[model samples]
Structures are given as structure tokens and as C-alpha cells.
Target chain A: GIQVEQSPPDLILQEGANSTLRCNFSDSVNNLQWFHQNPWGQLINLFYIPSGTKQNGRLSATTVATERYSLLYISSSQTTDSGVYFCAVEPRDSSYKLIFGSGTRLLVRP
Target chain B: GAGVSQSPSNKVTEKGKDVELRCDPISGHTALYWYRQSLGQGLEFLIYFQGNSAPDKSGLPSDRFSAERTGGSVSTLTIQRTQQEDSAVYLCASSPLAGGIQYFGAGTRLSVL
Candidate 1:
């Protein structure tokens, strides 16, 4: 089974700040996704970057498949972004069952 | 018709009781997954269903956990003789196919007392 590790288990920031979260996997993966679990417990998909980079509004993500690492960036963060960010991956040979990282808990104060 | 939907948004049961959680994936989606998220913890994969083939239950934590998909559309995860350790948010997600982006449901919060 592959192992995924997320950096900065917990993070706190004031509104209008910026931050970056990183995820490292132990094995090659065929699928990678970033998710944000809001206070209401909804796991919202933030990105589906197995490789390359993608951006959606104030959020952006980049995955370097060769390096087995991925990053999620939040620009000018808002209170609405306060939640847990998770990075999940599926190994190349597996049946696409995701292996999740411990996650980075983000708290944004207004 | 839209994103994934889960039933019984919240559930509370005795430690020795059995409980069932249901998930309805988006139409035409061929892949469905079940995951468990504990408080202040990460998502734990539980099961995977693809099309009509037999489900992959490798992620199930114990023998008491089982899931089934009917008509390759809806899925039900049944936990028998649930224990306190089973208390967590049960999340369901669907994707167009394996290795694709997943759309998650709001999740069902289960508490076994």
C-alpha cells in the first residue's frame, strides 16, 4: 500500500493571507486529487491534478508526478477556506482505491 | 441527477446494533467509493465499486463491514454489531471511471454509543 504524507498538520492564518500545503506520496500514482472538507463536513473536490498545474479562483494546485509530490496554494485566503485539506492518491497498479494523507487543518480568521 | 447524495445525514445507534448507510452516485458514473473520516483525522478508504463487477472490499477495516452495489448505481454499506470505534463520517463519492476525479457527498455522520 502506498503512503501519503501531508506537511504542517495544522495551520492558522488571518484573512487576506496566503499559504501553501504540500503532499508527498511513497509510490507512483495514477490519480491524485485535492479536497477541502468544510466545517459542515462536505468533502469538496479542489483539484484533480495527477500531473501539471491547475487553478480555480483563489486556489491552485500542482502535482509533480515524477517527484511524487503535490502542492496546494491558497491566495488571499478567506474564512470560507477554513477547513481540512486532504490529498488522496491511487497507485498505478491498484484498482484506483485512494490512499489519503493525514491532512492539513486550516483555520482562517476574519 | 447532480452530485453524489447520501441518505441519513446523521445516525446514532447502540454499540451492538447494525446500521446501514446508503449512497446514490451521479447518473452515468461508473465508479463509486465509500470512505470513513474520523474526527480530526483523514479519509479512510472502505470499498470500491466499478460498473457491475464484484466490489473491491480490500479497504474494509474488519469483517463486520460489508457493502453492495445494485445495478451499478446505488450502494449500501452495512456495519454489523457496530462498535464505538465505528463512529465517524461515512462519505460516498462517485467518478466517471477509475483514476478520474471524484465527486463526494455531504457524508453521513454516525455515532455509536
Candidate 2:
């Protein structure tokens, strides 16, 4: 059922500013993740990038999986990095299940 | 606990009564998942164990829902007669195979009044 489109669903920065959350998946995926539902929900497991770059510290990710998209980069931003920022995948028949998107609701403001 | 250990973080059943959510994986995990987040939506795909056998329950959201997993490392998600949209937040994850990288827990906020 692959179809996860997450973009500027909502965001508002200030802390240090620097955001760029985007995940677009409609097909081809072996497993690509980037979660961080903090603010209590606790899904935190940022970046699993199914391809290419990856960083942690200030958070960083980038998966191009043949243009299926995946990018979550929240640099200097703090305030506990706000919340909501999901982007899951596992397409390609999806056995172990994982298909979430409709997220990206930052809001950092110290 | 080394991660992925959900239990009664919160639950309040009533509607039809019959709730049982538990999960504890992460000791040589063999893939286990079950998600469901409602309030703001996103994250719903409720079932997939690979040790005690459960080949993608295909997001259980019917038949009053059900789940299993025994000696392979605990897992139970039963919602027999519950309603009220079944409340929400019931996540539980673990992965050490079958498309690894999953580790989550700190969920289980049923509440079906």
C-alpha cells in the first residue's frame, strides 16, 4: 500500500533554526526509517536511512532510494527538537510491517 | 530492559471490556511489531511477529483484534470487545532481522471508556 507523503505538514522553528523534513514513498523500499515522536509518545529512533547518508548528533538523514525520497535534517534546532517527525517504510512486500508518514510536525522555540 | 518493553503504561477498558496489551522483545529479537497511534493519526499497522509465528496480521483492526507470540519473547495484544475507537497509542516494536532497525516501546495507552 506504500504511499507515505510527509512534507511541511506543519513546522515552526526558532531555537536555532534549520529544518528540512520530507519523506515521500510510494514504492520501492527495503526499510527506511526516521522517527522521533517525542513529547511523550516516544517513538525516537531517528534515521535508519535505507540508502546513503546518515548522522545523529544534531540529527541528519538522507535516503534517495532511486528517488523514492527521504530526508530529515534538523540541525541546530533544539527545544528538545520539538516533536512529531515520522517517516517509516519497509515496502517491497512489507513483511515485518512499517508504513507511516503523515507526520513532520516540528515546532521548536526556546 | 534494553529497549522495546511495553506493558501497562496506561489502559482503562470498559466499553465491552477485554484488553490485554503487552510486549517485551529485544534479546536476540526476530522481528516483532504492532503499531497504532491515533490522536493525531499516522502509524497504524498492527501486527507482525516472526518468532512465535504471525506472518503480518495485516494491521489487525477487526474481529475485535487479537495478537499472540509466546516463548519467542512475550507479546500479546487482545482487544476483544473494546470500542471507543479502541482508544489509541499501542505501539510496540523490535527488530533484529527482517528489515532491521525498529526498537520502540513506551506505548500502551488504551483507554476505552
Candidate 3:
């Protein structure tokens, strides 16, 4: 089984600030995704990046498959961005099961 | 459905009772997954279904838990003789294909007393 660890278990930021969260995996991954769990407990898909980089609005993510690590960036954060951010990955040897990290709890203050 | 849909958004059951949670995946999705998230914890994989077959169920916590899919569109997770530790949010997700981006439902909040 592969292990996934996320850094900065908790984070608090003022609105309009920027932040970066990191995720490290023990093995190579075939698929990786970043999700944001809102206060209501809905897991919203943020990005699907096994490798390389992608950006969507104020959120962006980059995965270095060679290094077995990924970074999620939130820029100009708003109060609504308060919630938990998770990084899940599917190890190359696994078919469809995703190993999830403990996640980074983010709170954007007004 | 536009996305994964879970039934009975919340459920409350007494100890030793049985409960069933339903999930309807997106149209034509070939992969469905079940996950559990406890308070202040991360999600844990429970099972995965590819079409009508489940290839990975190693994540199931105990034999008291089971799940089945019919018509490759709908899935139901059943827990028998539930215990207090069974209380958690059960989440369902689906992907267009195996090992692809997964879309999750709002999840069912289960409380076992």
C-alpha cells in the first residue's frame, strides 16, 4: 500500500492572501486529484493532475511524478475558501483505489 | 444524473441495526467507489466497482459490510449489525473510466447510537 502525507495539517490565512499545500506519496501514481471539502461536506473536484501543472481560476496544482510529490496553490483566497483540501492518489500498481492524505484544513478569514 | 447522487442524505440507527445506503453514478460511468470519513479524519476507501463487477473490496473494514451494483448504474452499501464505530459520512464517487478523475456525491451522514 502506498502512503500519502500532506503538510501543514492546519492553515489559517487572511482573505486576499496566498497559500500552498504539499502532498508527498511513497510510490509512483497513475492518477492524482485535488479536492475541496466544503463546510457542508461536499467533496468538490479541484484538479486531476497525475503529472505536470494545471490552473483553474484562483486555484492551481502541480504534480512532480518523478519526485512523488504534488503542490496545490490557492491565490487571492476568499472567505468562502474555508474548508479542508485533500489530495488523493492512485498508485501505479492499484487499479482504481485511491489513497488519501489526512488533508490540510484551511480557513480564510475576512 | 449530472453527477453522483446519494440517497438518504442522513440516517440514524440504533446499535445492532442494519442500514442500506444508495448511490447513483453518472450516466455511462464505468467505475464507482465507496469511501468513509470519520470526524476530523480523512476519507478511507471501502470498495470499488468496475461496471457490474467489484475487483477491489480489500478496503472493507469487516465482513459485516457489503455492497452491490445493479445495471451498472446504481449501487447500494449495506451494513449489518452496525456498531457505534460505524458512525461516519459514507461518500460515493464515480469516474468515466477506471483510474480517471472521480466526481463525488454529497454523501450520507450515518449516526449509530
Candidate 4:
């Protein structure tokens, strides 16, 4: 069982603003992913960066594995971006299950 | 051209009743998982199936819950004598294999009254 902590438990921003969310894990992991839970409760896979950096559209993520931390950046945010963002990781020893972090709730006002 | 698919996007049942949720993973995926999120809670793991081996059911909360993957493809999660605490959004994910990125379905929202 690995521990995951997400910072800035709540965030509020105006449309077109920028924000950054952070995730810290307790141990080594070979599998890591970022997900967005929409208002309808759909879990959308955002990224699968076990390490290094990746970007998609206005969203970018970087994982510093040696430091056991990951950061997700959202640019030009829109009202549609409002939701809960979660980070999940698989500990090196247990590769089958993903341990999820308490998500950061984001709100983008138009 | 398809992601993971879950059936009966929502389920409402009475206490002491049984319910079954189905998930069809993307073709060729070798791993499937079941998870659920209680209201205002983080996602919680339930069970995992990989290939033809013994599933890792360690995450199941109790004997009332069980899941099986057929032919290493579709999966079904059964809850017997469901309780109020079982109300939540049940999510299913599939990965190419263990340690890979998982693709999730829209999830089945269950309400137990």
C-alpha cells in the first residue's frame, strides 16, 4: 500500500487562467497516470508518465521519479476543465493495482 | 476503435439484493480492473484480473463481492446482498498488460437503498 498526497486540495480560477497541481507518492513506481473525473463521473485518462515529461493540448505533466513527485499543468483553462483531477500509481513491487491520490478539485469560472 | 465499455450505465437496487456489472475491455488487453468511488471519496481498488492466472482479489472489501473475466476479455462483477454502503460509481479499466497505462470506461453508478 503506497501513500499519495495531492496538494492544493481545491482550486478556483477564471477561464483562460493557468494552474498547477502536484502529487507526491511514498515509494518507487513503474506505472503512473493522471485522470480527470468529469461532472458526470467519467474517468478520463490524461497521462501515463511513469517518469519524465509529457504534454497534451493545454495540459502537461512531469514526473520526477527520483523525487517521487509529479506535477500537472493546465493552461488556458476553460469552464469545461472544472472537475476532479486524480493521480494514480503502481508501486514497483505490486504492478497490478493502482493506488489513487485524493484528487484536487478544480473550478474554472467563465 | 473502441475504449473499454461498461453496461447499464446506472443501477438502482434494494438492500439484500444482488447486482451484476459488466465490463468489456478493449480487444487484446491482458489486464482488467474494478474500482469504485464513494461519494466525495477517492477511487478504491476492488479486484484485478491478468491473463489466465488467479486474480488478485485482495482489494475486495468482503466475501459479498466477486468478479470474473471470461476468456480473458469481458468481465463481470457481482455483489450479493448489497448494502447501502455499496452505492457508488463502479469503474472498470483495462491495460495492455500489468504495469501499463489503463483505459477506463464511463463507469456504472449504483444506488442501493
User: Candidates' interface RMSDs, in order?
Assistant: 0.9, 9.5, 0.8, 1.1
Score residue A14 of candidate 1 by CA lDDT. 98
Superposed Cα deviation of residue A45, candidate 4 (Å): 1.0
In terms of lDDT, the poorest run of 10 residues in model 1 chain A is A90-99
TM-score of each: 0.96, 0.34, 0.97, 0.96
For residue A68, model 3's alpha carbon misses the true position, in angstroms, by: 0.9
Clashing residue pairs in candidate 2 (N, C-alpha, C atoms within 3 angstroms):
none
Which window of ten consecutive residues has the lowest lDDT sum in model 4 chain B? B36-45
Which candidate's lDDT is highest? 3
**Clashing pairs in model 3?**
none
Per-residue accuracy of model 2 over A4-42 as CA lDDT, tens digit each? 999989899999989898899989988799888888888
Off by over 4 Å in 3: none
Error of 2 at B83 (Å): 16
lDDT of each: 0.93, 0.86, 0.94, 0.93
Q: What is the TM-score of chain A alone in each candidate?
A: 0.98, 0.34, 0.98, 0.98
User: Which sections of candidate 4 miss by over 4 Å?
Assistant: none
When candidate 3 is compared with the true two-chain complex, its DockQ is: 0.86
Report the lDDT of model 4 for residue B97. 80
Name the regions of candidate 1 deviating beyond 4 angstroms: none
| Model 1 lDDT tens row, A14-95 | 9999999999999999989999989888888899999999999999999999999999999999999999999999889888
DockQ of 1: 0.84
How far off is residue A108 in model 2, in Å? 8.6
Question: Model 4 over residues B26-95: C-alpha lDDT tens digits?
Answer: 9999999999988666699999999998999988999999999999999999999999999998999999
